[model samples]
Target: MTKIQPSAPLRSPHGSLLRRKAKDNPTLASILGSYEKFSTAALSLVVSDKNSVFALVEAFNAYRNEAVYLFESGKNVPQENLRSTMLEELFSWLFKDLFAILQFDQPTNYWAGKATSSYLTLTFAPKNFQSLFEDPNPKISKKDQDFAIGATVAIKVMASKSDDSAPALTVILPVVAIECKTYLAKNHLDMCSATAQSLKRANPYCMYLIATEFLKMDSEVTPEVTDISEIFILCKAENAERKKRQSEGKPPHPMHADVVWELFSMVMGHLRAVWWDPASSLDRGKVIGRPF
Candidate 1:
């Protein structure tokens, strides 16, 4: 018999809520159901090059449109009560699909055999106590990523240098962190930047990414200077087009297959490539750019 646990910091709090929204939306339900089944099937598929990757992404975009779509009426676009949550769940499903074809069964010290998952609640900041008057037992703070690939590591941070009684802090960290949004604004970018900075400070190896369907930020606002590794805008459609279609009772725009392909390739490259191996570099005689 297996024990059931009420989820908290273990995962993002969007799965159940998104499922509830799907209950009233049959198209979404079908798409999600089919996507979930890919867990066992996708590993059998072959993707040898960029062309194959793009082909797979094209099919995926078709499925994605149904799950994260907005309905058109005229000027008023009707959205699900859990619109943002549904969009969040799309990323959850996406990474799951991408992970399906990867080799996760190969055992490694990283990620503890839980090769891939989405909407994971990870520790951005571990148990921190700086002030002398702070609580005797300080609680840790966490942030949920739409998609993450990493390990839950046990770390010890002595509460006080002079005291022997205090124990270490255990942190649930993500090596690869991704945030998915239906739209991104200036404030959203700022918050994402802050998170990227905080998590990177804690886990320097962590790769932070942002994926959004629509771009709402100002033209001058770019993520290049921020801690974010990359930000992918998956659609060319604008808000006005969405509104016009919604008024006519049409579905939202589909994601660009090329953009999705880039995202998939980026993650795949990161995972498969060796980030650091100084000992092996001496023998192989190959040097790559640092943080390139």
Candidate 2:
């Protein structure tokens, strides 16, 4: 199949916010405009090499500083997932360009995974056979990843092993999943761990990752014991009360280019890796190690 060309996002998470905006809204207008600028800049230059990565990084950080960090508190932030939705759109714009260089044709949704619920799924019914003409009711558990490459497959099943069929069994499998959070607290970390296990159970080769703007844990906590591949702290801020601290005149922990580059490298390595060949690492005398 032919691959779709990379382009600016046709739609964004701000549709509802835009619809709900007061006639004289200014902050939301500025934020939405900044998002468009970043999207345009991202597509204007394709990340063909490391030099291009630098240009993209400059644009990416600029967006975070101007658009993402401007508002404070949910009451004034427009939407709780506003920042996260921006990340999803920006990452998809950038990653699509990068993936174009890799040039693999596959049926994976890049930016839209945020709408697809999750990286795993299940199907169940009493073989009701109520769906020969009607649609099946599949229970979809929402994963709602920030950035993910996955697909949902629905297979309609036969009722009693006969030609008559029942509700379809749908599997929402994510091959590579990235959860985006504005800030990750301890509780969020626990949820991430459980989600990682759920993804792994469905596809052992799945790459589960977390990308958070800040660490909100009471103390520094590592996720080594968890099945998550890695957590990218985009801005390694002193956590616990970053918002209150920032409101008190602390400097914004702007996302570092280095951190973004590290994330890009990790993703590329995972994409190029051979996960299954048992002897693939024997010649190197080492196992497939996760890159930090």
Return the top candidate by TM-score.
Answer: 2
Error of 2 at 70 (Å): 3.7
lDDT of each: 0.57, 0.64
Show model 2 residue runs off by greater than 4 Å.
1-24, 73-77, 106-112, 119-142, 164-171, 218-222, 277-292
Cα lDDT of model 2 by residue, 1-292, tens digit: 2334563233344433443552456666766666567667766776556676777778877776765555554664555556557556555654665456667664443333354556365555433576633443444455666677655666554434455545565556666788887788888999999988877876787788898878877656768888899988877875655676667876566776677777777777777766666576787666644333
C-alpha positional error of residue 105 in candidate 1 after TM-score superposition, expressed in Å: 3.8
Per-model TM against the reference: 0.64, 0.76
Per model, state how many residue pairs clash.
Answer: 7, 3
- Given candidate 2, what's the lDDT at residue 290? 38
Q: What is the lDDT of residue 197 in candidate 1?
A: 83
> C-alpha displacement of 14 in model 2, angstroms?
5.8
Clashes counted in candidate 2 amount to: 3
Top lDDT model: 2
Q: Which portions of model 1 show Cα errors greater than 4 Å? A: 1-56, 64-82, 85-141, 158-170, 280-292
